[model samples]
Target: MSDVSRLADRLQRVLARAQEERTERDELVDGPDGTECAWAAHERDQMWKAVNALRADDGRPSIPLDDIVQVERQAAGHSDYSRKFALYCAELAQK
Candidate 1:
């Protein structure tokens, strides 16, 4: 019901949609030839970064896009990571 909860729900839907697309494509191969997968991954990463930024300390401010992109690459194959990240964002949003 809260803003963070709403954001988390939206993110979960995004992740689910990405997963569905990947499944339909018979797995997403991230490379020059895999533009669709790459774009989906990028979108997921941006959403995660946006949520993360909302929880950053005042002094630290922004997280580098490169860092977020790297994390997205590492987490792309794991649906658990997406769910956990959404939960984390919700927790932060609560505070």
Candidate 2:
């Protein structure tokens, strides 16, 4: 596959894992002050930051979570959104 294709795949995996972590954190209802739920929440937050950084471009603002979701919906195809999303992932990964 091409570099953009590879990066898009990686982005998809990362987004999926982030969603899973968010769900796991939300499911926790009776944990200690800073235990299981806290750890998951922290992981979720870090994942979100990573995603936001990945989506940022030079001279452009980072995309919000809602927009990211829309991009995700369109990323499977070889559209302009997919190309930009792949480029963003590549830029972030190189850093």
Candidate 3:
């Protein structure tokens, strides 16, 4: 896929995951413990669900969730962040 499409797909994956936890805070999935590394890994995986959503033949570097704060800052809209933004991007992509 083109670079633009790749970025859109990546954002969609991240947004979808975020929307699922709309009411959730920025805290870890669980309390402080030995799961910090595991939790971080899981979060990174969740944020890249679209890494393979493209064509199977399209081999490319996996997208990484470098800074989650960038996404968190966008969680501001009626209803929810991803829910609304995802819808907007979907609309734009279709046009």
Candidate 4:
């Protein structure tokens, strides 16, 4: 498949893991309780790292987490999120 599409698929998986981990982190009662919490933080970091790696691969500046969070929160589940993500991927592609 095309490079952008392939990258998008990878990004989707990473984003899903990141979101799941973030939920766990947010729901924790004591806030970052060691290994489990560390894992959650690592997952979140992986998402941004993947994003940055993709951008750096194309010689583009890394996108900010705030910008990505904006995209993640743009719409309710199963609404226009996919379209937004695809558009975001396309923009990231810059190809």
Candidate 5:
């Protein structure tokens, strides 16, 4: 695949994996809807941060989550999406 396509594919994989982890967390923690909602919001915040970094004009090589990787992973492990929606979001995020 071309470079951009490869990058996008990798991102999709990351998102899909994040979704799976999130589902597991919800099951393990037994959090209420409000807590789950907050977790989802935080996950989106991390995603936007990553996207902005990816869109930056600097020439330096970067990985979007390299700085806040811990937050990204932890928050994602508790995201509240159902499997279908998570897959849908992953598909959209790639575009």
Candidate 6:
């Protein structure tokens, strides 16, 4: 498989795992110092890095600030819903 495809797959998995954990915790995953929240953010950063690695323009891993399309929140069959941010990558349009 191509390197970009492989990296994308890994990012997808990381995102999925973070979502699953947040679902199970039901938004009460935050600790006093917000360790849980921090961990989630870290995972998200790693996922972004994986995506950036696939890009050829720059060597540094980064997601364009404008590429984010939407964010969704889901409930895990509980009283409150958990936030599930979905960042959509912008596609190159042919002129």
Top TM-score hit? 4
Q: Which regions of candidate 1 are displaced past 4 Å?
A: 26-67, 70-79, 87-95
Minimum summed lDDT over a 10-residue window in model 6 is located at: 86-95
Give the lDDT ranking, best first: 4, 1, 2, 3, 5, 6
Index of the highest-lDDT prediction: 4
TM-score of each candidate structure, all chains considered together: 0.41, 0.37, 0.32, 0.54, 0.36, 0.36
- TM-score, candidate number 4: 0.54
Write the residue-wise lDDT of candidate 1 on 30-92 in tens digits: 643354555465555656555555656333445444544554555556768777555454554
Stronger candidate by TM-score (1 vs 6): 1
Question: Is 3 or 5 the stronger prediction by lDDT?
Answer: 3
User: What's the residue-level lDDT of 6 in candidate 3?
Assistant: 56
lDDT of 1: 0.56
**Model 2, which residues run further than 4 Å from truth?**
19-23, 26-48, 56-60, 72-95
Q: Tell me the tens digit of each residue's lDDT in model 6 across 9-91.
A: 55456566766665444343443334555545544454444445545444444555223212211222334222223222212
In the range 1-95, model 5's lDDT, one tens digit per residue, is: 65455545555555555555554344322232234444444454445454445545344344343333333343344554333233333333344
Cα RMSDs, all models = 6.2, 9.1, 8.0, 6.2, 9.2, 8.2
- lDDT to native, each model: 0.56, 0.50, 0.44, 0.57, 0.43, 0.40
Deviation from native of the Cα of residue 38 in model 4, angstroms: 11
**After aligning candidate 1 to the native by TM-score, how far in Å is the CA of 77 from where it should be?**
8.8
What TM-score should be assigned to candidate 2? 0.37
Pairwise TM-score winner, candidates 4 and 6:
4
User: Residue 7 lDDT in model 6?
Assistant: 43
Q: How many steric overlaps does candidate 1 have?
A: 0
Lowest summed lDDT over 10 consecutive residues: which window, candidate 4?
27-36
